[model samples]
Target: MSADQWIAFAAAIVGGALRVGTPFLFVSLGECLTEKSGRINLGLEGVLVLSAMAAFGGAYWSGSAWVGVLAGALAGALLAALHGVLCSLPRVNDVATGIALMLLGTGLAFYLGKPLIQPQAPQLPSIALADWSSNAAVRAALQVNVLVPIGLMLALALWWGFARTRAGLLVRLAGDSADATRALGYSVAGIRIAATTAGGAIAGLGGASLTLFYPGSWNEGISSGQGLIAVALVIFARWSPLRCMGAALLFGGAGAVGPALQSIGIAWGYHLFNTVPYVLTLLILVLTCRPGKVAVGSPGELSSTRS
Candidate 1:
């Protein structure tokens, strides 16, 4: 890349981070919440796909983008709740339930969203500060949706909620030691169910962002496992919500690689760019997410091992 080309590449990466990170922000925040309560939902990918379809269908049916977003959130919450209920059953594996939900979510989205594929839905409004400016590059620099900031704020709020509030203490206590929680007269299953529901609603809204606002379309192939990668992001952020936002934007920027490269006419390398987030996810998981370190941040009841 030439000097100007490098500048453009850097610019593209910034824009890509803004546009692409929305989904990551939501999903990561959702996963962070679930993890805080000592539960994990692998079904987030499914929730993403389902939310995309629902958002599209809703916008098409309701004639309002905001309504579609709410519909999508509901879909995601319902799925997440189902997973929560299933996991609440004796001997049910959360990981397995998540995988099943993923398949179920994807399948339902494809089937029900068939009608939405053809409609030309109005693009939802975005907060474009630079777009109003006379300068083009400056405008281009800030094409990201307003939700990006909201996602960041949510992380900060969650971090505070987890570390400094009564509800946060309950969640932490439940996640850290279910036996102790039960002894204290709290229902572990109930808290996990609530956590899963909240996580699902938020993650679903993230999926809605993909179809209703950013690219602003309803399509089956919209999500690219931003949801799954979010699960890994939780580990990378070590369960800190603020760190999850930072990690999400990083992944979002990585996700912009293919398009960012192509924007400057470097099409040949575009294929390699698409793998950036997953590769980063793997690297972060390995380098930053030491299993031993996770214990401090993790809920007492959650365990990939030692359960």
Candidate 2:
């Protein structure tokens, strides 16, 4: 490739990374928080869809992007709370409940989002970092939005709190042994509930980002399984918040492959380029999901074990 061609490709990748990684950042963080509390919500995929629908509907009805974002977050938190309640019941499994929530989230999103299939919703504000650049290549490389930095900051906060704070220590303990946490007078269910709720909120924001920001619109078909893949990204990042950011961006870059290639006039045969993210997900899962590996980093009571 010529120098200009290389610059163009690099610029496209940067832009694509920002666009695609937004959802991943939120979902991965949610999953991280949830996992840290000894539960896993596989229904984040549902959360994404439902949040997208809610954000669009909220924006369409209220004419404010912020309202839509808030509505989406509430919806996601409610879903997560439901999962928390179900999983907390005696003999009820977290994984099973998460799967059910997945179904519920998807069904509700489809039912309500059906009406928003074509309506235009208000757009959320984003940074046009590219505007600061003089050269076209530089401009293309700098179109990242505020979410990128916010997500990064959140990751840093999570990492610091996880390693340093007493509250973080308790969360880690709750995951390692609910009985131990209970022995210390901590409410096991409460910890899990809080984690799941927080996770839902984050995931909801991710969903809102898809509709209110990136695509700046919504439909039943928006947010194509980014939530599910984010579950895998958690594993890829080894549960580290900073690593989660890296993984999110990596997945985003992979997701951008199809569009970036098409823009450069190279149509990947049969649209195979779109499969990059999934293919990467599968590869990461197979590589990391060894016997007993899940139990290693995973919380002690969480239901995402290999068995």
Candidate 3:
């Protein structure tokens, strides 16, 4: 490849990062929020798939993309709320419940999304960020998803809220020491439910991005395990919203590598390239998880991290 081709490849990866990373950003932030309230909702995979189907169906029926977004968020919230409620029961295991929810969510989506596979729906609009570039490839690569900025702003807001607000403190307190929160007369169950629901809503938006924006369509395989990978992403980010954003972009770029290479006529090992993100996820888990040592900045009440 010449210099120009290399440049295009780099641009494609950057664009893919922005395009692909949006979902990761939303889902990881949602998980971070849920963990902050002393609950971990691993069912986000289900939340993500179910919401994507709901979003696509809503857009196809309503002829409006934003309506689809709303439908997705609502679906995610409702599903996540169920997980919260189930986990709140005596002697229920959060991890097992989450796995069950993931299965249920995916099954529901596949069943309900049958009619949606063939229809075209309104798609989310993009903001042209490379209008100045005469190169069409550059222009196409720089077309930013409208949801990217919104995700960025949400990350910033979450960071601020966690660091400097009463609500944030309460959430942290709940995650760190439920007994402490209860001693202060707060309802730990209630807080966890609310946080999980809110997190699901945000994750629903990530689903919306998948169907209504890049690779914009509804399919049983649309999610491709991104929701599951987000669990590791949160751990990699140390549960910080801002760091989640960066980690998401990095994963997004990793995801883009195969496509970007193919775009530049490098098709060999494409399948291997697509595995980068998953490999990265495994590496992060290995590096972060140690024998009997809690991860730094991990929520105290998060069960998976506790020794």
Candidate 4:
């Protein structure tokens, strides 16, 4: 490819990373928070879809994109709360309940979102970061979603919360040792429930980003399994919130490979390139999941990491 083409390709990947990574960043952080509280909520896939539907529907009706974002968060919180409640019941498996909720959330979204498919809702605004550049491609590539900075700040805040705050310490304590939390007069279940709900709300914002930002539309396939991929992402990041942001960008860049190639007149392998993120997810799981071995920095009470 020529120099200009190469530049365009690189620009495309950068743009794609920012756009695609936003949702990954949110969902992975949410999962990280839940895991830190000694619970796992795999139903985030459902949360993403349902929240996307809700965000779109809310924006369409209320004519305000911010309202749609709130709607999305509420939907996610409600679904995640149900997961927390069910998992708290005696003998209920967290993994099983999460999978079931995933199905329920997706089914509900599809049913309720039927009318949303054809409508155009208010979309979130963007920040044009490349206004100084005269190149159209560069300008297009640099147009960032407003939520990108918010997601970044959230990552930093979470890291600080986990490392320096009392609430953070309590959540970590609950995950590492429920008995210890109980000894300290804290309700382990309550801490976990709150963490899971908060995580779901964060993931819901990711869903809102999907429909209200890049692609800027409501569709059943908008998530493309990003929510499910967040599990591997968190594991890959070694449960670090800051590391989760980097991992999300990496996955997002991988996801952008297909489109980047296509933009440079390389269409033959576009579809194959699009599978890069999934392939990366498999590789992360394979490398991280070894029999009888828990990943380093994993919470002790997390069932998946428990031996």
Candidate 5:
């Protein structure tokens, strides 16, 4: 490729990192938060799909993109809360309950989103960062969605909150030792429920990004398992909110490889390149899941820690 082509390709990857990474950032952070409280919500895939549909449908009906985002958050929060409540019951398995919720959320989304598949909804606005560039491709590649900044702020806020806030201490205490937290007069179930719901709402924002920003549509295949991959991302980040952002960008860049290469007239291996993110996920899991290797900074009471 020529210098100009290379520049365009580089710009595409950078922009893709910002664009594709937004949802990953949100979902990973959400998972990080939940894991911090010693709970897991494996059903974020369902949350992603359902929230995407809800966001799109809400935007279509309300004529406001923000409203769509709200709908997505609410949908995710409701599903997550249900998961939390179910898990609170005696002898309930968090993983099993999450799987059931995933199926339920996905089925409900498909059924309700049928009409949304054919219509256009209001889309989130973008910031044109490459407007000064004469190259059209560069300009196009640099148009970033507004959600990126919000996600970044959220990551920073969460990291700070975890380190400095009393509420954060409470969550850490609950996750580290439920018996101790209970002895201290805190309700372990309540804390976990709140954390899970909040995480769901955050992940729901990721769903909004999928439908209201990039790809800009609601469909059955819109999520493509980004939600599930985010669980692995949280593990990779060792449940650190800030690290989650960095890891998300890495995955986002991997995901962008295919499209970036295609922009430079290289399409022969497009499908193979598109698999980079998934491949990376597998590699990360393999590397991280070693015998006797405890994740640095992992919550003590996390189920994985016990396992």
Candidate 6:
């Protein structure tokens, strides 16, 4: 390839990382938070879809992208709150409830979002970091979205909070031992519910990023298994917010490979390249999810012995 092609390919990957990684960043963080609280939300896929629909609809109706983002967050929180509430009941399995919620969220989004298929919604604002660049490709590559910094700040804040805050310690305690938490007079249910709901709200931002920013439209297939993939990302990150951020970027870059290759006129294996993220997910799981070995930093409640 020529120098210009190489530059374009590199720029495409950079741009794709920024654009595609945002959703992964948010979802992974959400999952990390939920897992830290000892509850797994498999329904984040649903949260992503429902919230995406809600965000798009909210932005479309209110004519404000910010409103759409909030709508998405609220939708995710509400759905996740339902999961938390149900799981609090005796004999209700968190995993089963989460799966059911995923279906429910998806159905609700599809039914409600049917009207949203054709309308154009307002898009979020972006920062043109590459405006000073002489190359058009470079300029396009560096047009970072506003949410990227927000995601970064969120990851840093979560890492700090988990390590430094009293509330963080309590959450870790709850995840490690429900009996210990209850013995201390803290309601495990309450902590978990709040954590799950908060995680959902954060994940909802990822949905908003999808509809209000990247594709700038609502569609049933918009999520494309990102929510599911984020579960693995959490495991891959071992529940570290900082690691979650890094994993998200890695997955984002993996996702960008296909498009970058296509941009450089290597389209023969475009579809194959798109499978990189999924392949990476499987590999990570195989490497980390070994038998008889708990992943480092996994919450005690989620450990094989407890589970």
Clashes of 3: 0
Ranking by lDDT: 3, 4, 6, 5, 2, 1
Each model's lDDT comes to 0.83, 0.84, 0.93, 0.93, 0.91, 0.92
What TM-score quantifies how close candidate 6 is to the native fold? 0.98
In model 5, the Cα lDDT at residue 79 comes to 91
List TM-score per model, in order: 0.92, 0.93, 0.98, 0.98, 0.98, 0.98
Q: Which ranges of candidate 3 are over 4 A from the true structure?
A: 303-307
Prediction-by-prediction clash tally: 5, 0, 0, 0, 0, 0
Residue 297 accuracy (lDDT) in model 3: 93
| Model 6: lDDT to the true structure | 0.92
lDDT of 3 at 51: 94
**Model 1 ranges with Cα > 4 A deviation:** 1-7, 131-138, 288-296, 304-307
Q: List the residue pairs that clash in candidate 6.
A: none
Clashing pairs in 3: none
Look at candidate 1 and tell me the lDDT of residue 79: 95
Candidate 5's C-alpha runs over 4 A off are: 303-307
lDDT (10s digit) by residue, model 5, range 64-143 = 99999999999999998998888888888888888999999999999999999999999999999998899999999999
- Candidate 6 local lDDT, 23-125, one digit each (tens): 9999999989988999999999999999999999999999999999999999999999999899888888888888999999999999999999999999999
For lDDT, candidate 2 versus 4, the one ahead is 4
